[model samples]
Target: MSDDVTAAADAVRHGEVVVYPTETVYGMGADATNPDAVERVFDTKGRDRDKPLSAGFPSVDAALEYVVTTDLEVAFMRRFLPGPVTVVVERRDALPDVLVAGRDRVGVRVPDHDLACDFFERADTPVTATSANRSGTGSITNPSQLSDDVREAVAVVLDGGTTPGTESTVVDPGRGIIHRRGAMADDIETWLAEHADSEPDA
Candidate 1:
């Protein structure tokens, strides 16, 4: 592993936060299973407690460990993950309740960024996937884009050059809904239509 990843991973394991790149944008992440660390992420962003954070994994299979999914939902995930998509699913209790704000569903992502994935793998923990910016503010696409406040809050900021500058498309495959559109909205919608049988209970 790279020294930067080692440092970032160590920070995460020690319940500290880091600003790291994702395929879509830079993310401010802390260990998802650590309620205090996760809380810090919310505090840093000025995000509401009611607005739960997403969990990021190294791969779709890793995400599935914490997110309950049907075969159809798994198929849906296999189709667009490791890309810019946030797939919300039934929470499996593998993560802290704080991550989902006591909700039974959680948003999860398998970002297609090697450095970010390697960091998560070394940290050996799921990470909160909220963008590295104040809530309701624009995302930071590069380390230089971070505000002074944001920069000062994190233990480390790994610069992986500029990102795509878009947020991940948030979708609930279980509900057959596109909760928020971003990077791959059309692709997600099309997949949902093709797998209408997997729709969640109304």
Candidate 2:
């Protein structure tokens, strides 16, 4: 497992796409900061070029570095992140257009899984957090769940066993919006209500 993680990190560093496990599901990623590498992810997943890709960071602080946030939101991140929520916030220009899709906002994640984040940290780059599946298909939870096309498209698949099968709940705290409700919606709502100065718009 350790050797595989090392190889995966190396692969990412060299601009190769790799399939890795996240707490929510398996993700097909490459260095999010690398435009060519990020393009590979979009190509592999058959993802829409205009659709933005979320980023997975090694830690909460690292993830926060790419987005605009307030103290209350940072507290929310500290509390629920490294878990199963993707926080959407104002994007920083440091992120490439491929990841942000020319938008001013981007979704960010700090995966709770140790192996995945270790790979990200070792690679020393943020990774695209899009699911390892063809567009419009269900996410891959295990290697066997990968389609033939998807299986053939990647250079490595780090089988971290079966994932939790629920995609992360996506929230835009600045707008008080829940973009997608999944594994952690209720908990996030409660936390936001307790911490946010005003209620979320949605």
Candidate 3:
């Protein structure tokens, strides 16, 4: 692992927030199981406490350790994960309520970025997967674009050049709902419709 990844993982383990690159955009990450660390992510971004953050993992199998997924949800994850998509699924108790805003389900992100995956694996814990920007501001594509407040709040910043900048498509496969129409909306919609009958009633 790179020195930066090791340091970032250590910071996360110590309940500090960090900024890292993702396939879609730059993301603010913290240990998802730590309520205080997760709250720091929201505070740093000026995000509403009511809004939930996604749990990031290195792979679908890694995510399975912290979320409860049905066969359909697992299929959906295998199809679109490691891409620009956030799959909403039931959260395991290990994931603190603060990360999900007291909701039963949480968004799961497996970013298709080498640096991000490496960080998650090295961290050996789920990290908050929200954009690295203040709430209501444009998502960050580069570390240079990060605001002073965000940059100062984070303990580490992993600059992976520039990212795609588009946000991930947030989908609830079990409920057949596409909360945010982003990256691959049409394809996700098509998949949802095709497997509508197979999904458990929401």
The residue pairs in collision within model 3 are none
Per lDDT, the best of the predicted structures is 3
lDDT of 1 by residue, 1-202 (tens): 3998999999999999999999899999999999999999998998999888999899888887787787777887898988899988888877888888999989988898999899888889899899999888888998888988888899999889999888789998877888899997997888888778655543
Full-model lDDT, candidate 2 = 0.86
Write down the lDDT of every candidate, Cα atoms only. 0.88, 0.86, 0.94
lDDT per residue as tens, model 2, 1-202: 9888899899999999999999989998898889999999999998899999999899988987777876656776788889889988777777898788898888888999998899888888888888999999988888899989888878888999999899899988767778999987998888766656664443
Candidate 2 ranges with C-alpha deviation above 4 Å: 196-202
The digit string of per-residue lDDT tens for model 3 on 1-202 reads 3999999999999999999999899999999999999999999999999999999999999999998889999999999989999999999999988888899999999999999999999999999999999999999998999999998899999989999888899999999999999999999999999999985665
Between candidates 1 and 2, name the one with more favorable TM-score.
1
Q: Which is superior by lDDT, 1 or 2?
A: 1
- In angstroms, the error of model 2 at 125 is 0.5
The stretch of ten residues in a row with the least summed lDDT in candidate 2 is 193-202
